[model samples]
Target chain A: MLRLHGIVGDRRDHALHHRLHHLEHHDAIEFLFVPEADLGRRRLRALTDRGTECAVSLDRDDALYDGAVLFIDDDRAVVVRAGAPRELRLRPQGTEGALKLGFLAGHLHWRVRFEGTDLCVVLDGAAADYTARIAPLLDDGIVTVVGNAN
Target chain B: MNAPALSPATPAKTAPAARVGIGGPVGSGKTALVERLIAAFAARKVDLAVITNDLVTHEDAERVRRSGLIDPARVSAVEAGACPHTVIREDPTLNIEAADDLERRFPGVELILIESGGDNLASTFSRDLTDFWIFVIDVAGGDDIPRKRGPGVLKCDLLVINKADLAPHVGVDLDGMIAEARRVRAGRPVIVTNCRRSEGIDAVADHLEREVLFRT
Candidate 1:
């Protein structure tokens, strides 16, 4: 059962999450509300045994693990906590012209716009003086970092 | 006859002092109630700590801290993650942990008051988490609320109808509302108060003294 077990955010959010957890974890899926106050891996295992699929919704802006069931109540604020195994989102930022040139050379074409920092940004920063850093490796499955105003 | 002998194989455990919860909609005067309890408990010299849940702001927690009745650090606030009922009822893990943390921080504390974030009806505390609880509603919401009989109102140990002074201005029949509340709960305790003015606080305190604090 997909029991929400417990909400991570605040005390007043239990019922709705309980309802959501129960609804998602329906018959045959044993749902248990585990308050983090008393949470342990053993508790997670216990729920897993109750049902095959285990899903937990985290607190507001909270990210624990990217479990099967994620509770997204509102999107106006930053997600401080997401129960997903890995919370992936776009990040944005503003930098000097040279930094922007290197940044674009690394990920100029992308599916989603994000201000996040990854290996690409880190590499780009280190190779700031090298002009042909990424151009040669772009087609070879190797991401390169080159910053030039051309 | 002699009492049964203790078993040698039994595990030893501390009787963790009971935890009590107080919840209700916003503007129902939960902070005011806490203030009153602080004064009342101080009169009785009870050692206690309070945990408050604020959905979008720390105003309530701040109020109790600044009240000067208890140490400001004795109060901690938890954010509601935009969904108040989930934290208190559905999940309640963070609140439980916070309460336990407080217990760890202050061993002398005998009473714990967990205030839920301001939320709508249908909010209730977990029996496993809280030993007893109270729900506060207000006259400003109208007198028919009792008749609606939300789960929170029906399940709470004490139902407080706060802001009594606004009944006439708000066009509510205060007597009828209180009577209907009694009718709904059958024999449960209900208190009418103007928490803003500190009226009817002692009666509420009296109920807590007997029911939760176990001073009797």
Candidate 2:
């Protein structure tokens, strides 16, 4: 079993991205899919695409994110891909609502991304857990769920 | 309880240093306590590092570094910006990163003291950031503080009632305040300290040695 200590670099880095692009052509890159809930975990045990056993123990401060390169060599590379997460899509009424929604999300430290005027919350836990927190905003009509809450 | 020794079959790995957080309101002597702890830990010859979260400047970090107690290189500072509690509680990534940097720079360090920016009594440290945390509240703040039962007063591993020397001058009943604190915490430990005189510091250091460092 390979014991991985920390990430090499993020795939978003231009240099690393170029390296990954080159590795893709040779099929030298292997991926380890981790659940969204486990992204914050410091220690994890998982298997690579090629069934390579791996034990990941990162520093207490380190958190794995999508496109995190775990290991790479001239011949092969391993990257972490976050599994699909349950998302909560919300559309705030206006600027005031947007600020409120943002504040709520920031306070809860919820992972979020904005697409146009819509806010997409990538849930680390059950949908109800996220919904319950923003229920007040929903009740106030400051924000509306755009799709299935789950 | 002490962690069991790793089996001979297991590959040796350096254990991460224990992270301890000190959080409290403004002017509550949080930095003073840090200075005192530096001297105390120095006397014991403990390998220690410090991380200070200042609201908008490196004032606390600079003071500790210039104190001639610990190495200036061993002290790191994190600017907490506007929301001090957010950096320590809601999202502690910055503080955690600072501590990790300290551990990497000083491999032999056994303890890292993280001091949060001065905040209200409700502020508390996230468990991910600290293995053990101490909340400082001084008698000058008010005897009613512990009675308020803020999360910092209730949830902290240790509650330090600093400024013990000013109890009478401030019209605070020290014994009654300590009693109320004990009652609110349901018999958890509370220590009173006069940082000016270094009184009660030994007890605080002893608690850390026993609980955090596991030096029984």
User: DockQ for each of the predicted structures, in order?
Assistant: 0.01, 0.02
Per-residue lDDT, model 2, residue B83, is 80
lDDT of 1 by residue, B1-216 (tens): 111122232221223444667888878888788888888778888788898888878878898999899998889888877688788888888888888888889886767888988777788887656767889999999899889989889988789999999999999999999999999999788999898788998898787766554444
Off by over 4 Å in 2: A1-150, B1-13
> lDDT of model 1 at residue B81?
74
Q: Which parts of model 1 have CA positions greater than 4 angstroms off?
A: A1-150, B1-15
TM-score of chain A of each: 0.19, 0.54
lDDT of 1 at B136: 92
DockQ score, prediction 1: 0.01
Per-prediction TM-score, please? 0.55, 0.58
Candidate 1 local lDDT, residue B98:
86
> Per-residue alpha-carbon lDDT of model 2 for B112-194, expressed as tens digits?
99999999989988767876789999999999999999999998879999999898899999999999999999998899999
Place model 1 in a CAPRI quality band. Answer: incorrect
Number of backbone collisions per candidate: 47, 0
For model 2, how does the per-residue alpha-carbon lDDT over A1-150 read when each residue is reduced to its tens digit? 555667889988898888887865565666687877557555556676556656665667677998899876666677888985457899999988899998988777565667899888866458888879989988999998898457
